[model samples]
Target: MGAEEVLTVISNVGIWRLLKAVGRSRQRLGLDAQRRRLVRSIVAHEERRRVDSEAHP
Candidate 1:
């Protein structure tokens, strides 16, 4: 998907679903390497926050 579409999906669905969506849309979207890296970064950041919150709570 394009940049805006990717950002929109990330914001609306959160990292996990966005990752899943990316898998589903890989052929259709043809997202470039940079975009994939960006998505991975976001997912990693979100995962860290999840772990931090769970440990704190």
Candidate 2:
């Protein structure tokens, strides 16, 4: 299983050091970039939806 799966299965109960290490490993695995782009796309889509609603209502 991936680090995320293991963390979730274990309820993420642990020291900050372990979480940080998993995060670093995921970053090295290119997880960070995927998340960043997904977040940016979601934000842009939300902004567009808000603008369209305001223009019509």
Per-residue alpha-carbon lDDT of candidate 1 for residues 11-33, written as tens digits (9 for 90 to 100): 87886777777696674465576
TM per prediction: 0.46, 0.51
Q: lDDT of all predictions, in order shown?
A: 0.83, 0.83
lDDT of 2 by residue, 1-57 (tens): 999999886775555557777787776568778888899999999999999999999
Model 1 lDDT on a 0 to 1 scale:
0.83
